[model samples]
Target: MQRKWMFTFILLVVGFMVAVQYNTVQQPSERDTRDIWAIRNELAKERKLHSELLTEVRALDETLDKYNASEEGNKGQALLETVEDLRQQAGITEQSGPGIVIDVVPSQESVAMGTPLHEISPELLTRFVNEVNRFKGLDMDIDGKRVTALSAIRDINGQTTVNGLPVTIPPFQIKILSPDIEKSEKLYNFLQSSSILDDFYLDDFILEINEPENNVKINGRSDQSENRYLKELPKGG
Candidate 1:
């Protein structure tokens, strides 16, 4: 009986040891499963971060594209405005403003005396134009022909010509534009007391200055010929 009791105690001890070993093995598998879940969570976070970075990069690219387009558009608009301004400065565009009209006619005395009307001298017209320019004439025209910086006033074959075009006889109009009404009034006042009138009288011509009128139009140059001597220079030359 004593031997059987000892044997039973030994079997119980062995069974407890086996149970502890089995529990240790099972705990390792459960821990490994938890570790795998943790690793998957970390991978998911990394993937989400990568996706957000890609989205931000794409947004930045789109913004950059929009900025480039806007910059190009602004450049184009600036170029157009510059071209228009140049056209205006070159007197290639029609201008209208408050100004005065000058009528050139034979003097009443000369007409009454039955004296033949003489053709206007180029020097007189040139001097008159210079005086008008000095008095703030922004634009001018002679008998409907636009006078520009490049216009040539001279005698061609005994006929007075402006920009190679013939000027009409006496009674032709000389239209001048001022920047504003105030300048127009100033010009009118100056002309009324100017010595240029005496010069006209000496030549048997009447320089009649009219009151300032609004909406005075001066046409642009009809000739579109470019200057043959003016050429664009090469870059870096």
Candidate 2:
């Protein structure tokens, strides 16, 4: 009887140890599963928050656009007008109006064989450009190259150049733009009446002028440097 009781106690203790070991292993697996579930829940919450924030941002952008179109309309319009003026002044935009087109060509009959080919003088070209500017011409283009305020016309290596580019040989077009038909006509008359044409003819350069038309286009823009320098004025002197 004593032996049997000892064996039974030993079995009971072993069973209790096995149960404790099994529970210990199961507890860790359960805790790990719970941890994974908690992380998934947190990630879902963060994703939801991000989606809500994006929705709010979109709503705010829509509201701001509406405000800009309504309450801030005049300011927007003024800003647009300012931008348009700048574009016009910069010649970055294509302009079309009544203007004149002049073509300068070599008069073959006026020049004799074996004589030097009649070359257009850079000085004459410069003078003509200056005169047009003085007359408040809106735009000018030589051989499709835009003539800006800082354009340079000079003779380089026996070739007449405009802004450092050689104009193609004879019959190059010079486009001049004006604001209206009256101004265009006035400019055309000025060119015809001026002595410049007579001087050109004397030099074997044939200058041809087109009648003032309503659809002249000035499509070239300036590519000059954009750097500027300024000096501060004296305080009181």
Candidate 3:
């Protein structure tokens, strides 16, 4: 009986030691897992913070560039250039450049008929304007009236009107300003060539082209309306 009781006490002691060893090993594993998880969370946060900082740095750089461009001396020049460009495009300022003047008159043969050739058709005039525009001709005028992109060309009561002005005369003056002299000469030749002249019955019309030695003056219009859909682009776009 005494031996049995001692053996039972020994077994209880061994069981308690095993349990303590198992608990010690498992506790360290759990703690190690928790530490790795915390480290991963810290790295993720740092990555997010780095991305945010990069975005802010780029924005600040753009702001600095804009500020430098808008400095006192540079600002005035930049604004002047921008305004001049806009004025030129809008035809709000007089331009002096190398260009051509064309005088169109009704041929005697067509005038004898006195039906279709009494006055030039608005369709033909519009086609001519479109061709000149295609060749990058700037600051156009028809019979002393400014021709703009917004100008209306339509027939009214057996007569053609440009921007609501009468153009029923036998001879019409068309003035065009080109940026280059060579281009103006090319356009003049093209207008007289068979490819363009033969497109219509221009044989019933007399077209005379002349290029001035000095600069040709072109007038501007004050009635241009502002665009409604013009908007600035967003930053970084």
The global C-alpha lDDT for each of the candidates, from Candidate 1 onward, is: 0.85, 0.78, 0.75
Per-model TM-score versus the true fold: 0.64, 0.59, 0.57
Flag the better candidate by TM-score, 2 or 3: 2
Inter-residue clash pairs, candidate 3:
none
| Root mean square deviation (Cα) for candidate 3 | 21.6
Residue-level lDDT tens digits of model 3 in 1-237: 999999999999999999999999877655545587799999998997798799879966865575577978787676676668667777777777888888777776777878465666788778878877757446788877678888888987777888777775668777888878888888777777735454445647776677543477767764555679988899989
Ranking by TM-score: 1, 2, 3
When 1 and 2 are scored with lDDT, the better candidate is 1
All candidates: CA RMSD (Å) = 31.8, 27.4, 21.6
Q: Which residue pairs of candidate 1 clash?
A: none
Please tell me which predicted candidate would have the highest lDDT against the true structure. Answer: 1
- lDDT per residue, candidate 2, 76-183, as tens digits? 775676567667767777787788999888776665544456557788888778777657646888887778776788889999887787777667888988889899
lDDT of 2: 0.78
* Model 1 per-residue lDDT tens digits across residues 55-141: 879966865565566676586675576567668766788888899999999999999999997889999999988888765337899
Ranking by lDDT: 1, 2, 3
Backbone clash count, each prediction separately: 0, 0, 0
Off by over 4 Å in 3: 1-70, 73-77, 111-117, 156-158, 199-203, 226-237
